[model samples]
Target: MGVTAVLGECARIFTHPRMIFKLAQRELNVDISTDAYIDENRNIEQTIRADERFYLELLVIQAADEEPSTHKIEMYFITYCRKLSHNREASTGPDWRDDRQWIPGINMDNGYFQMHEYQAPAWAQHLNHIPSHIVKLTTLNTPIHRWSLPGVPDRFQVFIKRDDLSGAELSGSKVRILQFLFAEALRQNARHVVTGGCLQSNHCRSVALTCRQFGLTPHIVVARVSKKEELEAKGNALLYRLAGSHLYLSPTCSYESFSQRLRSLAGYISDKYREPCYCIPLGGSSPPGMFAFITLFQELIEQGLFDNFDDIVVSIATGCTAAGIAVGNYLTGSKLRIHAVSIALSKEELTKRIDLMLSDIGLSLGTNDIMDIIDGYIGQGYETITNVSANTGILLDPYYTGKGTQGLLEELKKNPTTFQGKKILFIHTGGKFGLFNGEMDQVMNLPGNHANYINEWPEKDIPLVQ
Candidate 1:
């Protein structure tokens, strides 16, 4: 299904006063104008038709910066769909769809929108009740800032959407994931939150800050730094310690071994503490985490950030951040092409991971189906820096934002056609402290004073004496 069809359907079903007025004035019937709704429906149906093994389930609605009132409408929409369906699978089932239903609504004195599911869907089923709490995040309309490397394309203006400045300590992309994580933690009655990541993980730092804010203890399991030379006391590591996070370090191990260790640690923490402990995977790369980006995209649209650009570029690390941003763009009916610069995984592997994450959340998005443009710009392996990366890191961090920008610049150079006359916005998923130690020395190659060159001065004092 095409995006336009889905948008048209959204306009019809959402049925705002303005939308209703437009429809009335245009004399367009809802039945005729509802083709937009079928775009996603057709896409889903086509997949189901093509694959007999796959079954259709509930419609997954990823909530973005939707207000409490607006969210209620979303909840009602899902609930109605469930109540109207005959098959249990057809109804809104467990996962994010169900999770969003219980999200509490904020009280508006004006009574703008109510949290009432007036007419339930036919597929509604009374199952185990789930308690939910709404998380509040401050979304801002900050002006876009653009930076670029020398000799880059004139049309390709690299702009950073500063989610890093969302708050002082709890800033960056991690805050979005923490909102849902903390809410879930409270819902499960967890006293401590456990998560895994690298030594200088932004997600870990943000999680720690969130735990502090909500009066919950945060325990972080950090992977051992393979390169001793890269270890430093600044950036995310410093923030994590400052936030009073319980740190657990794992020795050198393979990827599977690392996972096993993290699992064992989580189990131990849960058993020893005798209190519910929530474990958040590395990068907070879950459906809930993806919702943060969805909300971010919504906020971006509300702030009119997409007005000047036809393309959006983001750096892909665990693929979760990029996935979230991609999904958000999809949901908002934005046709803007999304370019993801993979920092670690190949395009195929990254797509698989993203698709699995989406499916786990009961939302289906094919990696190939997603509008992501991947380019070969990851100079070295994950967390490994190159000369170009180092140069970029001299001005930006290598961990998240800097590497991402560097990749974006490289991709822009390679794909001149798309970037030639189009404005590109790069989402800087903050990791600045990763570039602190001796980065300048490596990038600039500065020489010691009075050591490299002899002073070019004449012996004027001797001539005056003669």
Candidate 2:
């Protein structure tokens, strides 16, 4: 009853109607319906299937949408209602029980269906008919692996989404944002990139690498942290340097002023060098950059990720990725929740940033964000380190992932009864390099964690290649 339960729900929705009725019968409380919008010519038949263990295996939504395609909001909404028929426990009240509550309102703009809770899907792909054409950053549909922790009450299931393996250099959730940011740069035919982030910012590393690949120069501006040494120390900063990005630093902590200064500097560079310069905001939190997660959430659906988990937890630093995930679920009719744990900012600051991004994308759907924010984690801002990564056997960075994860874990431990039988996904947005700080090793290694390398190191000398 781990993520397999989610897989079951997903599988039932995509399976043939014959299989669905059979599955519903087996489950006793399940319902399957295709009468939401009748286009007899439309095909409810899917080309995907379930696997062993009643798991909801993955499916790649075909990029083509003719009429209420699974890729579109209309069909996804209907399909989600169908799946909700099975998992009726997550929500409460008559509103949750009524299928009509899930029925989308007609899009006044496009005549397409939109959720009552969110704007239409087109707003996600394009803001006011302007395209957010994102470049393909990486082809990593990271797998969700299941891990059970000891000493946790109820033995509730936990699944971790490995975005840490999203790429070799352009790793972490930030790359998803860069996919759109860099695509915009390419669209503008820019020859140089300017961006800002914290000293060890993963977005900076991702942007620098993208610039290297796309033949654009990258200049990074950051305010000084007492931990400025940690930037040269390792992790994302090391990768940023390795990508050969020009570095600009402000000794003061006036980040907004620093961003404006960087903007001015980019203009100067553009004028002096006679090449177009694109300036990216901190953490790539613009509309296009934020829309990358919309693409990512869709990718999760196509990859069958939605079928495997109930909740997704992430570190919400600047709120870009979290905004995407939250909005994507609404746009795509995926009934999933993103639990965003604050890494550095206050919840109000996080909410404000997300709202600002939504405004940028021509949306004013709800005053309340579509996601939940947990801010008990940022005890000393980005300085306090928690060893949750060690206890959970995951590689969480001391500043960001570890501290945030610890907050979530402590809350879960305190309120175990609330999440009983629920499967949670902890997204491991990659910052593996942060494990090594400065020239000195920051984290103590667990015994035998690296033993596999030596034991399986080609048997010392198998044979030289011919």
Candidate 3:
């Protein structure tokens, strides 16, 4: 902490790549500085971190000439040094580039010089504090990872928000929505929950599970397009049975029809029980449900993700979360542009949904707000997309994430001049269980030569249940 030591460290760090790489490689785990990135077209570049204790101190050196260096070594030494200083039983970390070895215990790889593996120091405060109105549901705050895929343009960077890891049994983006809806139900002094969706609806499954968790009984009215699907308890239906929920499968086509059918059903439930009930609209896209996604955007800001992203992309089925985030940026006074990649709806339809949700929350998003809908990703229907995950270790379901990602790539290609220097942040809405509903024919029919591909789909990730 002395002036002399600080002066010596500064003189040592802001130097040439040979020195930085040599020093980093020599000790590797003890140095505070690493990754000497030099811009090819510019001389002035800086990496800024808001919270000093939580982030590795980044200082970029400006050169008089334009020269790109390939030797930008990663500095995980600061992380190791902090561990040793705190007397936390420190040891040398293994190579971060090894995909096989994980960052110790978190069941995920520590990417980019083990930067991903490091945790916030003890001095760092938790970003998300539960609100007075909301009770504890599943654990909040999922990890975000930098995702690099083959065939993607090198200039664009992609990151995924891991909403799938939000819970064990009810792991999906639906959990966040349930957290807010359940809290609102409690505030309204409701006794039971009434919600409706398709047979394989993640939203209904989450509602049923969360209702039981908080001592409220759940009544689910499930609707399918056909009589055959109505009779079957498949995918999300299995979870409903396991949760012991009261389910009624009604034959219907659209959310409008389902909502119409659910209204009479919800009325009957209240009359039968002689108690108040909270009724959630289809896909939990109401005003209260969108609160979780606003919290999601708030989480991104706390973690300093908003500064680096030029475009934020998310898949939309019901368009609730996408609408929440788009309007959330406006609520947070952020000018960040949101691209709602449509899996089912058209750009006009998605825009209407966004407009409707914004109205539900009583916020008016002008026509020129930071919201754009990029359509044409839905191949056949909501149940199918063209992109396959043949050992990519990431699964993007056709209903949402896959379609959004495909649209993002296409958008970049169509408007190359605009997105040439842009960075993308892809919000992954989880549908891992839905992957088991159909065959992996679209994923397995790989025609190109790609590396680091797992080749075969791991059936073990989602075990079959009788």
lDDT per prediction?
0.57, 0.60, 0.58
> How do all models score by TM-score?
0.62, 0.63, 0.63
Put down candidate 2 lDDT per residue, 20-83, tens digits, no spaces.
3344445444343534323333223322223311422112121111222322433443544456
Better of 1 and 2 by lDDT: 2
Q: Count backbone overlaps in model 1.
A: 16
Clashes of each: 16, 4, 2
Write down the RMSD of candidate 1 (Cα, Å): 17.0
Instruction: State the lDDT of candidate 3 residue by residue for 1-466, as single tens digits.
Output: 3322332343333322233333333433334433334323221222211232232223222110212121221133334334433431111222112222222334442221111111222222122222224445566578888776435676677777788787776787887777666656755645578898767678877887776655466788877645544445556778766676777767656667778877777788779877667898888887655666777787888777667776788888887888767756766666577777777777777677677666555565652375776777777322223333533467666566766777777777676554424677778778666655554455444555232245476787978889
- Between candidates 1 and 2, the one scoring higher on TM-score is 2
lDDT of 1: 0.57
* Candidate ordering by lDDT (highest first): 2, 3, 1
For candidate 3, the 10 contiguous residues with the lowest summed lDDT are 112-121
Model 1 alpha-carbon drift over 4 Å, by segment = 1-132, 137-139, 146-149, 225-232, 254-257, 373-375, 380-395, 418-421, 437-441, 444-466
Residue ranges of candidate 2 with Cα displaced over 4 Å? 1-132, 225-233, 305-307, 366-369, 379-393, 416-421, 439-466
